[model samples]
Target: MLKLNYLFHNENLAEMIVKNWSYDPESTEMFRYYRISSNAIYPFRKDGRTQLLRFAPVQEKNKSNIEAELAFIKYLRENEYGVLVAVKSNRGEELAEIRTPWGVYYASAFVRVPGSAINQTDLADEIIFSHGHALGELHRLSSKYEPEPGAPRRWSYIDVLDWIDDQIKEYANAAIARSEVQLLREHFADLPVHTRNYGLIHYDFEYDNVFYDHEAKRCYAIDFDDAMYHWYAMDIEQALDSLQDCISEELYNHKKHCFLEGYRTAFDLPEDPDAVFPALRRFANLYSYARLLRSVAEKWDHEPEWMQHLRTKFEQSMRSKSTLFGTKLS
Candidate 1:
């Protein structure tokens, strides 16, 4: 979530971003805050078409990261993969930077995908199948993608593990979390890597980042913010992680079977993808624990009521995951 101070002053900066894109003036009137975590997103109608403006503080994201993200999106589009395309500003820039007294903010715009997001309650089999196929197709394309010269590259999974260690090392549970991080780093180091089984991955390929177009019978993926270099099976594991909480084990097993079946249609699978999931789940847990800790650790004078409630929720989650990791590692 955005800090209280930034939220208060975001309106003027948002207007500046819209104008830089040369969007219709009415877009400013339609601007509505959509999300606040990791990035601040606003959805608005641009000439009667829905679009989104996303910006993040330099501390969270930098100009080079945004440029690399858009470049990958362009590559995916060129390869006929279904993904959101970035919108260029009037200055012919895919990413725009605004200097502020608080900090530098990088902004980018994208055409809002034209489909409803799927959730746990009403996830149909067809959507589940297409979800797997969509990720598989992306991995296939990623294997062949080479960034243009002088373009920034996405971070590797090990780089993120190092980051999580640095960010959370001072917290109460840092020792246990750091041990798990070391174990994960060593395990991945020993694993074999090849273009076919490892490449760029959508680190958060869950239902929220994907949309199903009913008429077209396809899935469009958004939010490449967490894209990174990792094993392809790690993507499948992350996509299936949420199902464990909401469904019976039998049903989860059935869904996994269906998902992998669809995945095989687009990309070849590792010989034992199932065996790799337990370690990957540990990685996922540690990463989420670090992010929640950071959110709860920030200081705000006169914090909002919602933030208090959110902080309580985050604390509960932190304790739960901390115990879970301690048990798994021990």
Candidate 2:
């Protein structure tokens, strides 16, 4: 019943969905939709407010996962975290289900955060410190979070490892990838997980996902689509990994101090944070490779030249063990 070829390219269907949210299709400017994983992202504006529209195929995200994501966003908003808030549809539904001839898709809208994404050139100590503090606050809050019974839980590290196992089974370098997975599992098994150190975290808490308002001195987080349950230390390491290109040895030491200083103000951190870096970096790289594999496997037959180039680059990175985190691999 569904037309696979026209699924993502259905502009008329997209416009209809947008209109369901009480926005005029004629007045609203729908930005081009691009693929992020299996989802399609469409950013648009109406009535002086910028909004983001997201669509995920049923195969990508189930109804429970979508509801859980929205619930988490509501929780963050209730706690006063500067996260993009989900918008309700005309029927007071936070999520919209669209059944098209091409298949079913889940749709959600969010009010765009004010300000631009933080860039490498503007990586000041204060901004970095504040970024750490924001994450610390989120962790602190997550430590006490208890979802209602039967609510969807985010993917665990084990779940990701299992996914990697399935993805790399036929990869050219399956043996090496399997070894990395085993090592990561061993490392994670040794890491302590307690109330203070383990919780749901914004797995993609990178500069691009954070919008900095200079006037307000605030960093608003967006894109919680990748939030997951993990060690708080992993979140910290992920944040630093995102800044590797912007930091030199001397600058890293200073920024690390400042960042940790701000973080400590909100929640307690481990004394030897750097000791955990090597393992976490490996974990990050493995996940990155898995993601690249997923993308390539899903679209290889119809992939654009640029996507093919990206796959090549990712394969090189995996082989060299060189990633955004740093040159050294553990």
Candidate 3:
């Protein structure tokens, strides 16, 4: 989450950032302020289509990092992959760096993904298959992707583990957390890496970030914010885990089968995909735990009732996850 004070203090910041883009000034008032999480989002209308303006503080993201993300999107699009198309700014730049009183921010725009998020209650077998196929397609493209010389690249899974190690010191149980992260580092290092089994993957390939197009019977992915280089099976594991929240045990297995069946149609599954699930789950849990702790540490001035409630909820979640971090993570 961004600092609430910074966001509120700079009342005109969003407007200033919007000007860098090629959006209509008249529609500025109609631009709706979306939620702030990893990034601040604004949804606006243009030429009868909705578009999104996303900006993140320089401390959390830089121009190079944003460019690396866009490069991957461009590659996917060129390969006929169904991904969101990035819109260029007024100066024909994919990224705009704006200097504000609070801090520097990198802003970018994209055509809003068509269709809506998959409703967990209404998840269908075909949708599950489409979701799997989408991820497989992304992986297939990711395997052959290579950044041009001197271009920035997305961080690898090891980089994220190192980030977790650095972030652990700020937690209340830093020592214990450090040990768990160390164990994860060792475990990940031992995992075999072959071009066929590992590469960049859409780390957040679950239902929320994937928009389902009922008319085309296809799924389009969004939010590559968390994309990183890792075992392809980790993406499969994470997607399956998301179903646990909404469906029953029986249905979960059935859905899993359908998903894999669809996945195999696009890309071959590793010899033993399930073998990597445990470590991947631990990685996912710890990564989220560190992020949640950081969110709780930020201070808010006259925090809204809802924000306060969210903070308390995050704290409770952290407490529950804390126990699972040390010995269990090992």
Candidate 4:
């Protein structure tokens, strides 16, 4: 825990909050504000009040992304049909000049929304419809909202293919790569079958970001960490397919149908949604395998030789005609 007295108005974590965090990790208990990243998040709870102090650094990678996320939250509150809320911290308070153990600290905050995050198994009828509707709403909002003059949001299907191809080249063990290549190639081939559209998007809406109250039968979205202007279709596909394991045929169909139905209710899906969905889903799966290959390789030291085994495992899975959803792909 880096001492951040000068940052938090000269207050430490214990001085700022009243909680039973004493039994928590010693490192967290040190700073009244613990930075989740060198310059991202610092979560502290006091008197049942939890606040995430966020900041952006000048020299940080995607430092400007902080601005984008904040802007997105502002947009969501105004237009989207969800219960999520954003907390506006003092401007430049996060980007303000402050000294710290990690260099400098920035500041931002969300409403400290509470609930269990969403999972695939939580896909009941109403929730499925809601997720679909949310996606559609997002697409509609993105289509109407304009980006900040200049944004990086024009990646193509070929570009996605290149990302997967490059990852496999960069880190794949030969045994794994060879087996996974067939499925990847098939997916890449299908990419040309669909066209892409650009729009403002909540590019990071994954299962964990969605809150599901199974009892109340309501759903909510949070965590605008990865929101950005992007291909709206790609963003939706990435969120739905990549984040949740759609392993059962019935469940996958139900989820996909509900997602589409809900989304269409809010905004217009493409005329060719059937084609668009599968192409995008294929790309996401290939991308996931690419990620798996690299993570296993880089973190090999942390997990022994399991790296090779996992790589091979995903490699073989890709070759199967059926997706995790149990649907056979063309």
lDDT against the true structure, per candidate, is 0.79, 0.74, 0.80, 0.53
**What tens-digit string does per-residue lDDT give for candidate 2 at 1-330?**
011232235566566667658664554445554444445666666676778777766766657766877888888889998889888888788898878765777888889897777763377888888888888888898898878898877777887888778877886656767777877777689888888988888888888888777888877888877777788888899888777756787788788778788788789996577888778777877777666665555443675666567667755765556233222344
Which stretches in model 2 have alpha-carbon errors above 4 Å?
1-13, 27-30, 33-38, 170-172, 247-250, 298-304, 320-330
State, as a TM-score between 0 and 1, how close model 4 is to the true structure.
0.59
- Candidate structures ordered by lDDT, highest first: 3, 1, 2, 4
Q: Which candidate number has the best TM-score?
A: 3
What lDDT tens digits, residue by residue, belong to model 3 across residues 1-330?
443343442337777887787676666665555657778877766676778888888887646667888999999999988899999888888888888765788888999877778754278898888888888888888889999999999988888888888876866767876777888888888888987799988888887888888888888889888888999998998888886765788798898898898898899898787777887888887787788777677775888887788788887876776665667433
Q: Candidate 1 — which residues are off by over 4 angstroms?
A: 1-9, 245-250, 326-330
Q: Please give, for residues 1-330, the per-residue lDDT of candidate 1 as tens digits.
A: 343345443676777666767577766766554677768887766677888888887777646656777889999988878888788878888888877655787888899876767563267778888888998898999889888998898888988898899988988758888888888887788889999989888888888888888888888899998888889988988888854654578789888877787788999886688888888888888888888887777667887887777788878987877665644432
| Clash count, one per candidate | 0, 2, 0, 10
List model 4 lDDT by residue over 160-273, tens digit each. Answer: 455556656755343344344455556546443322255656655777667766666556677565454445676667666643473375567657777778777877676664
Q: Using alpha carbons, what is the TM-score of model 2?
A: 0.86
- Write down the TM-score for model 1: 0.92
